[model samples]
Target: MNRSARRDGTPDRGRGNPARSASDKRATDKRATDKRATGKKDAPGAGRSGGAPKKPHRGQANTAAVATNKRGKPKQAKPQRQQVEANPTISNAKPARHQYVQSAGPVKLAAGEGMRLQKVLAQAGVASRRAAEELIEQGRVEVDGHIVVEQGLRVDPENAVVRVDGVRVVVKKDLVHIALNKPRGWQSTMSDDLGRPCIGDIVSERVSAGQRLFHVGRLDADTEGLILLTNDGDLAHRLMHPSFEVPKTYLATVNGVVERGLGKTLKAGVELEDGPAKVDAFTLLDVNGKQSLVKVVLHEGRKHIVRRLLEAVGHPVKRLVRTDIGPVALGDGRPGTLRVIGPGEVGALYKAVGL
Candidate 1:
């Protein structure tokens, strides 16, 4: 047995082999010294015990850096970025180029020329200013028969025939108009000195406090019908004036059957105590043995004008109910019912009065 052999009979290779040349040994030793100086890594599994893999050398260059090209695509010749110095006093700094951009809307009106449409609507109790603008934009508003679809349009409140959703809106804020079914017992007056039922009682119930309202025309205590009430003094005067000739309709239940010629006789003209009175139109609605129902239309606001005309024709009125005045109607309203006149009806009234 050789003394260099191990217990398994394998010879150790650490000592120089007798078959290797001295020059080869010297070359191998030079390689080991170069590896140590350059910090080169050993092959994997080299110098490892228990079949474990070898670890990377600590001083070796990073694998990624070694793989990367040393001279990458020559650095791009980039333009140097201009660095702007921020103004320390920002408030005093002016912008480079100032732009004055006007937002889109209706053209501005000259001062004192006219009022805004929405403002006029709000003042007239139609709707809020914002809501009125929405209405105008929706093409629901009109001025002088032209549908306006923009905001900030200036309009003459007195002259512009402005309508919202096809209903004319009177731009007068301080005015109000109402129609009431005047019951038979109620007098057509603001108040009764005798404490009898008068218009004030109905006004107090319907109108807000502090508003001064009066009937456009008078109705007798025994007469039941539609009566216009308003705070507009000029409108009331025109409505009651005989010049405008705003027609009024009345339903009269009279004594005795009315003959066919009664309407023609009333239309032709009837002699009255105050002078001659005539009906614009007339109709005999229903006739019974004891009572007759007649419909009469007249523009006269004289006291007992309908009664006088009917009596002159040999038919006395038993019950007189005025059904309409101008464009307004009683519309199945019970006695003592007060209704607020809508803008459309008010517009009709204005037309009837040359306003």
Candidate 2:
């Protein structure tokens, strides 16, 4: 051995490298620890040390510290699993809310419920809701035969007798729907300011103004036929909305023979000054070499739409008559005719318009 390579009887300096250094340090520490333990054990009478006793590792561990007897089994605890039934009271509880749909009847009302007398009158079929309100304002509506103009007056439904225009109201208990054959020069309006003839004037004396009559839509004062009059506001609203697209059929007489392209123009939808307009159906009613009559139906009720439509296609409407709206049709009733609409007819009218 070279003298420079030997130190303390060792032939060479210890191994060098990460693994060898770590392993050598561990073996050295374990040997030093074992010597300390042996020193303590050799002197059983050694004084209490500042630190704890040396622990026995895997080689000298006490078997009884953590083990069962090798040849015998220890008793195990049995788990208690209790079975419980579901609660019947929670399952049987009633729902908190209920739904209410519109019903045709004398709706039971309470005092101070905020329901108005005219609304009750209208719903009871004494008149159109609008007409009923008008009658109430006119002081024609009476609660228990006393004229009441106070709109906010809430009357007890079961205890009140409502009369309009001196006529006892017998709420028809049915929706009233009528299709009037509107004559030339008669307007489709509840009340006319110019005092010219209106569709109401044409209603029979039996179906008086107090009956809550009203026009469902607008018609030029000169336009004629198949005008709808009804007391069902919901049905009217549905028929008027664009979602329903309720079609109205009309027969128009024009000045000259209209080209087929005119019908096409109407069908394709014309952009009017008001807005875009649509025609669901159109056909030539009659065509003479000089004059022509055409039929057009639309889901929209634009202002003077029939006239505007004919003008868009280069033909001015010399005359116009609404032949149908939804399911109601104008048959052979004379120009000035009027009649009461039956309950079935009203239901059919509502059904036709998809109420």
Candidate 3:
């Protein structure tokens, strides 16, 4: 046998083509090394598919380690993770905190606590809810002295000072507004210093303690009719102010017949002792042989204005009873009777003075 031949009759690796021998030895060594490291054989046809086993990437693998099943099919390996025990005494999360801030504008009432502003105005007889909203939109309504335009704004009506058209509205529960039918001889004064019959005697038993009221306008000792008495000073002042021009109505019995042209003359404005005055309206209701029952409407508050106006027309008044003031009327109420003004009437009065 040749000295370099193997016992199987194959050329000895050390005796084959030198370069080819080296390459075959390296290939054999690589396969043996890979088998030792992986403890597994190459997949069938793996060498023909890619020609070589690729080295691991520079970084750790992102994929899970793979394994083979009983059928030699690859399956994902269960991930291995370090186990950690929880410590009840320590936590990394932070707790939450709550805070609140108040505003400088009108105080905001909590939910379901106070009444709506427009409703308050409506209840206080300022206007209907719809009209009150319109007033607020026009920048004419105020609450707690600030012009509030927001609808449904909550308010404490008893505490809030509301105004419309610059006229203060009385909303407090303790404040009283009364309409008294004065007797013919009852003085308009709150209290008669001379011990004569006056308004105080009539209202003293009707009102609560400490509720002192003042008359809006005075009537003569002989005149009788509807007179407003209230603790609302602002309303009284506005009603009495000449610029407001709140019309008053009177039923007067005068001597001699009222001429047809008398109403025209009275409305044309008759010159009075203090100033020129005019009747807003006039109507002759009934005619007797020598006396006439006439209705006169005027905005003047001059002393005995109704009597003076009638006398100026050549028919002197014998008895004059005011039937209405602004939106209020006596409505056949007996003498010395007192009635709390209704909300509608009060609202009408507020509108009359531009409130």
Candidate 4:
């Protein structure tokens, strides 16, 4: 083998050239310096090393004592994270709180000092006492610009400002009385749930707007006659009371011929399902042997009183119509017609009811 050839059959250039030998030595030294400067151990399988790198100790990873500066000095302990003390005066440390307070109770009233709100409203013809209470509860009734929801609240009727739904309520002193010649098949109520024709249909248009008119007494759907309509609840109530004895007169056409003494029998008393019903007067108007027209007067306002009384006497009434209630007569007003009750009739009604 030649001197330039190695035993492994490779060229021995580094041994043959001094300059190449010096260059290889300097390259190795530079790599060693670089590794030491980076403070990292030589990698495995790198720079003639052929083993896996050693792992760092478990606890030494997080310890500040294991960490060092470039000069091999331990890093100054991260200025020890200072503890903060909370200042109570600072709003961020403790949030501001709100204090709550309770509301005041209702005001008390003296005895008879002010009229009850419901009574005033009812007397003003707004509604019944129960309905007025509902209005107050619904926050619809207000007095002097304040909404009143409490029951039994009273205010001066004449002096205090009362309103319903922002409309000032004025208590009407001048009472209105209307007499209607109600037609058959017309309900006595202002409204009917079954959509039947009601007396209000004929009388409501004639009366002033916002006037709440109620029938003084109810009449059956079949009966057509003089029925009183008024907003005067007190007068109506008194007229309807049993103690007042406001008489009602009716003309009934019966199926049988009434003999003489039948009037006396009816005047005496007729035993009814409710109680013994008595008529003030009963008169036979006309008898044609086939059917008879009879006039009956009674103070009781029982339902179907005239029909029931005649039926109990074996004479079933074929047609019944009320002609008079107290002194208010049906006059010449036709069926489904209404007329204003004159002052004379109104006075007589009030006198009859003792109102």
Candidate 5:
């Protein structure tokens, strides 16, 4: 209630507390010191006022220096590229080596040195040259224990071992030549698809093992008589070739009597569907009032040529029999029989065909 007391009856501390004022002054000073220290530590370039901008820290200084250098000076020239040589032999680079190398091409042989693979097979009596090629491609032929599929491979026949169908083949100096009197209802081929009779059934009994023989030409089922079977492929090929003009003789019995001058007419030529057919020679063997037997010799190997010729001339063939081919004859041998041809006969056939 004196000069220091207010109308609300509270005493004023501003005139009464010395210790409190001193405590406030110390706290204010400590706060000011802490603020100055924090400002000094946090502010950049605080200790280097009025001087050149302080250098950055070691890592930052290096980065700034690099950037300034890049902007201030021209870039140094890059190292010159080295020249590379293309040739491996001339350059230091080595050519790549291969573990395995392929052959450049097929092998070649000298003339008259080695025989062809097909020819060797034919000489061995395995088959004809064409059939031999097929056998080779079928992997049925081998030389010296290696399968041979490619044709034209020359081999030393005397030294190189050959096999067909797992059977060894020996080179034969004397080839086999056979003449078969193929009977009616017999097939000239070695096998028949219809299970009928085959010429192989008869010849297989006479030939040795691993020796295969084939007919030189085919005759129909109803046809009978001379059919040459041989292992001489060259001779057969030459005989069968139309260019050789090897003559074949046939005897035909016709249903009707052949008119006079029919022999001459056939020799001259006859019109056929395929082409003109002609006989090299013709002769009337026998004739009756109703039927006639005629002999025809032709060089062309046409299907049913003799019968077709007679049919065109108003005569249907009753029976047909091939009597001769080239110099080989059926002879008096009974039907369904075969005989080994003499060497002289084979030589004659070879000569006839210009082998």
Candidate 6:
């Protein structure tokens, strides 16, 4: 065994530690000193955690800067705006320029004129809204040299050029709401079956074929009086709905004079096999020795409700005549004769029924 540096100040450089020249030994020592001073590491990924170099943070700069992409390269960004209204702040901002838009709707040729296209055709008494739509589809309506097939298309009236079936239409001056005093022995419908005369027959030349007129309500072939016919559908429906509870007055000719307490029983409420019934008000107006005409005012449109009510009170109705319904009555209206129900008369009926 030989030792390079013995315990004594003597050199034994041989065998295991080969002897080196002075210059070579100096060079080797310089390398070890340089490594210690520069802190050169042995491992390839020295000072790195989990085999990865830590990413540069917001405040930190790159120790070894990488070359950037071209000038056209885009920067990494968050999600982009999705739709027009996504940003409320931008949406609420004022426009940079004045915005003006014109609708392709029906226009009145004259200034200050206001009317819908479908309604203008209907007012001209040509046809109804549905019928007007048909006219448009048939290419009969033209506006400003353009055939308008779209019913939803609106136009300027005065400037707009319109022709229906090649005929110019003028919206009518006014609308009419007329009622007829329906006579008895005739069905309350517009037309009659069983070859019987209808209430429409009694209305005379007032109702034109082009006008859309219908009865507000119906009366049985036997139930006569105040038959209201009008072109107004909304009024007819509201007046007929049971929720309104419109009072209808009737004059019923019963077999016997109603008993003394019979009126009380009716006023109190009488139970029928079908259901209970109540009269708003009742009074025995006449009694001619076992014959009587009882005027019944009730708010019911049930099938044969008046006759059934009389029957429930032990008085079967022989003949029934409706005197009034809601705000109109059959005044001096003969069995088969009719008169126009005036506004004054209608007003009284409204008060009587509290409409």
RMSD, each candidate, Å?
23.0, 19.3, 19.9, 22.4, 23.4, 17.0
lDDT of 1 by residue, 79-125 (tens): 99989778876665576796866545344467678898889988777
- Write one digit per residue (lDDT tens) for candidate 3, span 250-354: 999999988899889988999988888888999999999999999988888889888887887799988989889988988778999989987667656777876
The residue-by-residue lDDT of candidate 6 on 212-314, one tens digit each, is 6678777777766666776645456766777777788888888787877777778788787778888876777788777788888988677788888888777
Best by lDDT: 3
Model 2 worst lDDT window (10 residues): 40-49
Q: Which lDDT values do the candidates have, in the order given? A: 0.81, 0.70, 0.82, 0.81, 0.79, 0.65
Q: Can you tell me which runs of candidate 4 are displaced by over 4 Å?
A: 1-174, 206-208
**Which ranges of candidate 5 are over 4 A from the true structure?**
1-174
Over 248-309, each residue of candidate 4 has an lDDT whose tens digit, in order, gives 99999999789899989998898999999989998888998789999999999888988999
Instruction: Please name the candidate that would achieve the greatest TM-score relative to the true structure.
Output: 1
TM per model?
0.60, 0.51, 0.59, 0.51, 0.52, 0.48
Q: TM-score rank, highest first?
A: 1, 3, 5, 4, 2, 6
Per candidate, the number of residue pairs that clash is: 0, 3, 0, 0, 0, 12
Q: Considering lDDT, which of the candidate structures 1 and 5 is the better prediction for this target?
A: 1
Q: Give me the runs in candidate 6 sitting further than 4 Å from their true place.
A: 1-179, 341-355
Where in model 2 is the C-alpha error above 4 Å?
1-174, 204-209, 342-344
Better of 2 and 5 by TM-score: 5
